[model samples]
Target chain A: MTALASDTRASRQPISFALLAQVILIANSFIMLYPVVVMVLSAFKTTGEIFDHPFALPDFTQVGNFTKVLGETEMPTYFMNSILVTGTSVILILVLGTMAGYAVARYESRTNTFILLFFLAGLMLPLKLAVIPLFILLRDLGLLDSRWSLIVTYTAIGLPSAVFIMAGFLRTLPLELEDAARIDGASEPRIMWSVMLPLARPPMAIAAIQNAVPIWNDFFFPLVFIQTDERKTLPQGLTTFMGEYTTDWGMLFAGLTIAAAPITLLYIVLSRQFIQGMTAGAVK
Target chain B: MLVSHKQAPSLKRQLWVAFLVVPPIAFMSLFVVYPILSAFAYAFYDWQGLARGEFVGLKNFREVLFGATMAPVVWNAFLHNVYALIALMVIQNGGGFVLAWLLYKEPFGFRFHRIAVFVPVVLSTIIVGFLWKLFLNPNFGIVNQALYALGLDSWAKPWLGDSSTALGALILANAWHFIGFPTLVYLAGMQRIPPEIIEAARLDGTNEWQLLKNIVWPLVAPSTTILFTLLFIGAFNWFEIPYVMVGLDGSPFGSTDVLGLVFYRTAFGNQSASIQNFGLGSALATLLFLFIVVFASMLTLWLRRREIQF
Candidate 1:
């Protein structure tokens, strides 16, 4: 009887410890998400109500703030610009990076190895350090204040990691397929395009998401290169909007929600893919 | 027919390879590699905007390092970057490590907790900065209100308004924004550990604390190296949060000034002024780049030496 009692006591200790851990984990997650919850809740409240009962649930669901931000500000335009820049840049990055990654993975040559090393070196080069020269370069090319400038810059900045990821993914693919395609008299381009490209789609998606997020979120380049209000990306536009509407807390919150909503919703929907893509780069 | 086709295809393949590779390489060289090299050259010439002036031969470096006008700003920004590095390492990465350990146990709702913690990471820094700014607002912000409600009103000062707490607040916000990254990475590292080794340690009557300390911690050394190196680089590279939240001047008496902001202001000027000195900006950039490279390499090397292999 004493032995059984001691066994129960020993077992009880780990269970109690696990319960403690669960409480801590839940509390930590709550703290992690509290600010985001506050933002969403405050967005639905009026300025008066927010101040009056900051912690309470909104008295009513209010779409008025969203309407005001979308209708009144240049927010829609900013969103369009962000989409145009990020979409074009991501497409170009995936295409070019995949090609480069294929070359590095399949072509066994000293030159190919050297090129891979060169691209890898770019991973360490903080583009912020080269902003001055890039600014001058863009100005000289007559590309300043143009969305194309951002597209090009983002593509260049994003390529290194994209290439690295694509190459790593491609290396994992069975070479037998490519070899068999070649034996069947398929041209190298055809093999790559039809055989390899389809298999590379998963990694392509990962690279696309990885590259797209930063470009969509980028404010630094737009702040420097873009001058016109219409040309501004969402992040840059949000900052300018905040500066102008510093006093209008309700409207500012609404504007922030507008800027954040699409990505936030996308993250919620495709969170598994997002998390996998993000962690894959580091883990591999 | 097959023999003739083989010769033609081999030549075509080389052309195809060139077509595939050259465009990205040329584009990267023109935009990335060329600019970096020119930045090195631009650091030596006393230039404003685009027109190059006479070669100043490290005069810009001298001004950035020791000149009465810019030295304090430079040093202050560098110090703040260091402070941010230390704070993020302790609070953000340290918190991430703890959370990873707990999650590794497969507690209830672990998946929900993982997803929730990582949600902020996908949001833009602009959104994060503005959201936090509103939350920390003294007059009507939730933080102050919550403090008052909890009867801790004495602790509810202006979080971002005062200089003493401004940087700290920014650090906390920054940590909040990125904690998920390290958490997931550490979790990945922890998952790589073999279950048999852990089960064996448990069979010897080791408690959770002992097993974690003796077995898990050493195995996750690679994650530690990766996280710390990234944190170090990111600390120096920080701009967007401070830029969006506090403005480029690192407001509240420049308490949140960082090297990235200083480089921006020096090169492009701010709302108050329009002094575009390319030489000094490039010099600052060069110094920052060199510091990051040297220290990061050293840290990585040291950490890698300590990493344990299973």
Candidate 2:
């Protein structure tokens, strides 16, 4: 009887341990998400109601807050600019990063290490270090106040990491596939395009998401380079709603919702891919 | 698909590669490299954007280091960064590691927890700053409300308004924003650990805690090194969180004025001011670059020495 009871106690310990872990995880996750949830709920409330019932759900769902955000702010224009900048940047990064990765991976000259090191140096130079110079150069080129400024900046910024990922991916690809393409009298660029680029869809998708999210969320570039309200991106535009009326939590939250909704929605729909891509970079 | 450059592209193909590559390189050099170089040159010339002064070699460096006012401000910012780094490493990374470890076990309904924790990471830092600004409001903020409910109303101070706690408060918020990335990274690292190793330890009568301390941790050291180094570098060069939360001047006695914020403030001079002191700004930028390089080198050396290969 004593032996049996001891055995049961030992068996119950793992189950209890797992239960403890579950409780901790659930609690941590709730706390992590509580602020955002409050923001979302506040977006549906009036300014008075948001403060009146701080922890409660909005008394009623109101699309009015979002409408107010859209009407009062330059959100639509910012959204379009974000889309244009992020799209162009990602496309350029995909093409150039792939080509650079191909060259670095395939070529084994004294220049290979130097080229890789050149790109790697960027990872060390924080954006602030270059912010001053970039501003002046952009102004000189008449590129300030345009979405193209951000596009070019984002491309340069995104290149090093994109190349890093693509290089790792390209190295993993089998040599035989390219060999056959070469044997068929396909030119080098043709082989890269027809043979390797398609095979690189996984890493490309990863790089695209990794590049797009931050570019979409960037405020500093638009804050400095973009001088006018009409050229503002979502993040930069959201700050317009913050001048002393930060107490009007409802409208502010609504603006935040407008700014954050797309990314959050995409995160929900494609979380597995998001997690996969993020983890791939971390693990590598 | 490795190939030699000797299997070189034809002239037309070379032209295509050149077309694709040269534009980006030129763009990078023009926007990134030129500005940096110009900033360096500006450091020597004592110009105030209008009248160009003769080159005063190392004068700016001497002023930046020994000048009473800016020197103290720079030192204070550096100290704040260190405080932020310690807080983030302990609170954010440590909490994240625990969560990742829990999720790795994959208890029933673990997927929901993983997704929820990571959700805030995708949101913009601006949004995060604004969100926390509201939540920490002493009057109607939920934090204060919760404190009042618990009869601890005295404890609920104006979080962002107070200089001493303002930087700390933003540190927590910044940690919240970035915690997910490190969590996911650690989780991924933990996943790569061979399951049989755990099974072997378990069969040897090892408890879960013992198994973790002995078998799991040593192998995850590489990820830890990467996480520690990256977070250190990120925290050392911190800007956006404090900038958006505390404003450009690092307000309420300038408690949160990290090097990046100071540099930005000098360059652009905020909305209230019109002075664009390009010389001082570039000098600040140069100082910031030097600071980061020195800090990163020391950190990398420390981390690399400890990085264990399993």
Candidate 3:
């Protein structure tokens, strides 16, 4: 793949053009990253200093903002709620999507094609369009104003893309692997579990990253459904905090940091997977 | 079928397939499909608060489509969405093609640059919106501050507060947040173009521009299709960015309003805005859904058939 990517003829551009191109790419990266860096740095600065020097590096030793956000506020509750809701939804999506995708991939039938299309349809039309009835449905189920409402909605929302990704990847694997497992007398579920699924890690990661990022960061459903502060996710909770602490730049930036840090750290650490996972659809 | 497993292996396989597929599809039916269908149904009824009052038979659609109060707002917001879609296609996707071209050339620190480009895409839209709102603040924002330092004080203004600039600023923010996506996707498409084709083209004396025009562009048609379809869907469904940056009301006289925000405010009723009109809101939602599905599907098929020509 590396050799293919770095084509020999492709590198034959003039040295001056390559230098100019590298400079432009570096500048673009700077433009992309500079503002986020400012947000993170502002979290560690004093409110007065943030106003005075918006671009200056903050004093790293000043742990006051972090402590205040963590201890003196509802940040922890929102954090936990985001984790619970996103974690639960992703788990359900992966499990259900994989099972459903396995069925659609291994079983060749008219029903399977229809099922795949049904799920694929969800990918194009966002669930947010149906929020009005969804809220009513949750109310009827006595799940509104609760994390369960968010969990179910996100699971449903994430499944279509997950199933699409999973099924597409599963179809690319050779049929002989499944035949070998069947000849070994493995049950259908066992063959899927031990053989097919292990090979499915790439798609699972892609689907997980695809779903989890949005689920963790989603504000709309939580904004409408979970009106109670106790059930509020990070994105929505951050807004309420932003309003209350509008003048307190230090705490505001700290709140933003807390909401953003986990995903940012994970992306930086596992960037290969994140990029591959998020952009997997376009490549196909 | 379950009982006849010993007599019929295919029937047994069918049972396994049902077991595997039913639970998830049922879950989706209960949550995603049912609610959406209900939302479409709600568009046909006159609603008194949450309950359906009577079958109004497109009266709500009339009010939403042609009523003096909503018609202008909805179309204006929709026009803004179109503007955003066009602007993003040009600035973000077009810029991305150039960036991908550069990266495809394998520039210095290209690997690090690839990761850097995607960092903003991973951040929440809310965070991106708010961060930009602060950056565009009139008095102390670095954007204005930098302008002043450069002795170009005329360029300084409240980017979000100004009616003329608010929607453009939001589009720019959206582009910033998502530009990495198109860049990488295009890069992936470019990498898939076998090197031998490029070598042959270079031997034919095809200049860089000619190579891009004649060889790479057509080959990357698939990525273009996916990106354009997604951009259309995303543009029409845009909510979070404007909602976060401008407010639920697409403020400064609604310069930044879009269908997603209008749908939310209508269905849920903002305290400062209109009261809840679930019927009318559902009409807008249903229309938006169908509009997206129809155009996106058509675009995909059209681009797909065009791809075969390459």
Residue pairs whose backbone atoms clash in candidate 2: none
DockQ of 3: 0.53
**Could you tally the backbone clashes for each prediction?**
0, 0, 0
TM-score of each: 0.96, 0.92, 0.93
Top DockQ: which candidate number?
1
Candidate 1 per-residue lDDT, tens place, A1-284, comes to: 99999899889999898899899888888987888877877778888878888888885568788888989889999999999999999999998999899988876644788888889888778887899899999999999999999999999999999999988889888877877887788877888889988988888899888888879998889998999999999999998888888887778878887788899899999998888877765775
The C-alpha lDDT values of all candidates are 0.88, 0.79, 0.88
For B198-250, candidate 3 gives per-residue lDDT tens digits of 99998997878898888898899988999988898999999999998999889
Give each prediction's DockQ, rounded to 2 decimals: 0.65, 0.55, 0.53
Per model, the share of native interface contacts recovered reads 0.78, 0.59, 0.79
Here the TM-score of candidate 2's chain B is 0.90
State the DockQ, from 0 to 1, for candidate 1.
Answer: 0.65
Task: Compute the lDDT for candidate 2.
Answer: 0.79
Q: Grade the docking of candidate 2.
A: medium
